[model samples]
Target: MDGNTNEQPPAGEETPAGVRRRPWPLRRGAAPTGVRRSLRMAGVTLAVVLVSLAGVVLGVFAGGRVDTDIGPFQATLTLTPDTSGGTTVDIPPLGALLLDSHDGPTHLTVRLGALDQMRTEALIDDPASIQRASVSAVEDVRTGVMRLGLRTVASAVLATLLLAALVFRNVRRTALSGVLALVVSLGSLGAAAGTLRPQAIEEPRYEGLLVNAPAIVGDARRIANDYTRYAEQLQRLVGNVSQLYTTVSGLPVFEPAPDTTRVLHVSDMHLNPTGWSLIRTVVEQFDIDVVIDTGDITDWGSEPEASFVGSIGVLKRPYVYIRGNHDSGRTAAAVARQPNAIVLNNSTTTVAGLTIAGIGDPRFTPDKNTSPAGSGLTKPVAEQVIGAGEQLAATVRNSPRPVNIALVHDPASAGPLSGTCPLVLAGHTHARQVSMLPQQPGLGPTQLMVEGSTGGAGLRGLEGEKPTPLSMSVLYFDKDKLLQAYDDITVGGTGQAQVNLERHVIKDPQAGEPVPVTPTPTR
Candidate 1:
């Protein structure tokens, strides 16, 4: 009997059932090879599918939603899926953050997609977290090299393929197929990660703000809460001015320019004499031909009644005063009384080579939290609110001189009217007590800024900081219609005894050339 044949069993090779000890050479040798080939192809196919899906989900979908925020003084992030419809994301005020002290240590909030979220979070906390997360997310996508996920499935497939190649020589280079896939997938993922989330500064100008976001967010939160509380108290205080402690004299003084544009961009005055005095100096020094008081001329509906009205008279330039929410009723009557002052209740004006449009406060206070002196708490009708926005639109549209400038008190209104006019000057968010760059889009790239009294800049308002303090923006427009110069006049006298003027020039975007203005003249 031959080994290949079925014959009587030998002693050692006897079958368990005592049958023939015949080895079917052809069938026995081919079984392992066939099984291995099938397993290898299946494993390779699975790896390809997973890598492809991950590329689509992470690269295509996640790349579009990258946005950043800084300052409420405490860096905290709330990430919600931006579902089919609209999404409302509430950025917390600094006061709301659960923090220990009012200073030190920054925080970061990162949002990752469903697939990589857990892995990414682990990497963020680990020693080489950032590097690992970024590498894992993109290794196969860009480099076409083997990544963990791709490599995992690839290895399994490759093992089977290697076995198959050994079994079936006619299969033609089965072992090398996985190597190609590994390289291609790794390269693809790496490319996708680099393109989508580069480690370098996305916006070089905003880099500082982004870096400082964690710490700033914490401080800003507490400041904002204090402001809101103060505003509530001040609202009641304005009803009885005798109780107020702060005065205009305590505010910073302004230095007027020798030559006058006659335009005054006074905003977030907050009825503090310090701010008013600074505004007055700027007006007189510049010999302003016209004054545009954007809003928040008064601290709140409260404060010494005379302070808000008197501050207007103090400006040497004839002014156009718009009502800010803080002024509410207190400043309206006073504005109406000023013969030289054009009181725009969401109206237009053409004065001194400028076509100016004004909008009153745009924020909707659901309830009359507090009323002006002697006036009962009153909630306005919906139409009145809508009408105010319409009036602003109409005012801009009807401007006789091709709308050169826009004036409003609340910086919030700027969001709607930013690119509409050549220049938009507003007050509310008084530069955040310590000013930084204007963080609004289409505003400026650099974080260069103006300081507010107790409140903040428009960025603060966006951060939910209420009743930003007093400051003024002075814009100098040349004859060619280019804004030659800009100035942020600080309004208070706390740290600085006198008014401080931080000025800069507008660089032309197309030319990348700076258009210089005369240095700010000293008082």
Candidate 2:
């Protein structure tokens, strides 16, 4: 009876004929504790992997290629995990960013993270320079930057390992582990979003590179269509630029002492903002005490350009202004608003220890709104122009200072005043010329200097013709407050101060000679 009881039930004793309970392969009840724990840990590992994968997908979506536009320039931004595991942006050649004259070297420098950087000392004058310039500085990249990036990755890995160990330990620990994992994921996402695309950029200093390639092409086409002699115009532009760098090398780079007075003669700014920076450089370089602007501050002589008149503030020195035919009364009013600006319209004043007298343009344009006699006035106000010149000459002749200087907009207006002052500075010819007019009775030979359009013939010059040289002159004063030296400097738009380009004509005041000068080789 006992044997019968032990072997009585069949394999499917209480089940249907073909549907038997599948054996779990173990005769023991339930699974062993180790097996159960192993399964649970496997699940935890899988979940961690899934969450990490999701985070990666989210980061990829959040951080995609970004585009930026600054003025007429265009550039692309990209995200990259550097060798040290830190996020960084790789910016494609920004093309030309219209470098701020106050910032940076004349070269392109890639600033990555904090200490990772690379730079090319050469300016991006040609398009090809972009590629050559993108080299990374191995030392800068590997030093401080690597340490920072490694530290970040080490922290993330440490957090992940600790969370994983806790999560695999037991079900009760899952909640704590999950919370920590979520915190890590959130931090990762935030870091990805913040570092992938910088909210703003500190524009790099570059020169002569294409900004918006399409826009640049369109501008070129428009220029060609408007100017009949496009080739000739371009040739002239390049020629003048070459000549400028060539001849300026022959001039001395004087390092005048402090407490000395230097005069900067900037004429026909023509609303070209570039001239302001040029003026500032000359002021600091030469220890200039005064800046004399010979009008034509704007191209159109319109009220809208009045704000540009505030450029006088950039000089940070006493500025003397005389109205040009291209300048209007509104422009004069703007210049007068500056605390450091003195409007010598048919008036005489002392500045930087020198006597300066000047007159305003007489012609307001007969029709007024038609055109400038120079740019806005439709017709030249001839009678008034000539008459004003005569009066300004008569008034400044008796100035008390031995070194009397006259500032006039148009050289034509300055003709009658040649011998009236010790030195007469004028613009409008768009050419640089210095001459000693026939000596007056009591006056030593009076110097009549006509400076090139500091704006390179204003903006109009860029349209009809190849602009004349962008030029300016510096006047040095002796301890006796007498005129010491007058030097001329020319520049190209690129601001590539080349010591060697070609040959050019440099005039010498003392020798009264037009010397052919060759540029020195770059250091």
lDDT of 2: 0.54
lDDT of each: 0.43, 0.54
**Which digits, one per residue and each the tens of the lDDT, describe model 1 over residues 412-491?**
34444534565655544444321222344654322122224322332233234233333555566666444555565542
What is the overall TM-score of model 2 with all chains considered together? Answer: 0.48
- Against the true structure, what is each candidate's TM-score? 0.39, 0.48
Per-residue alpha-carbon lDDT of model 2 for 184-236, expressed as tens digits? 54455345434442222334323332233233223444543433332223323
The positional error of residue 223 in candidate 1, measured at the CA in angstroms, is 15
Q: Which lDDT value does model 2 have at 484?
A: 55
Residue runs of model 2 more than 4 Å from their true location after superposition:
1-221, 224-259, 365-382, 398-403, 464-466, 493-523
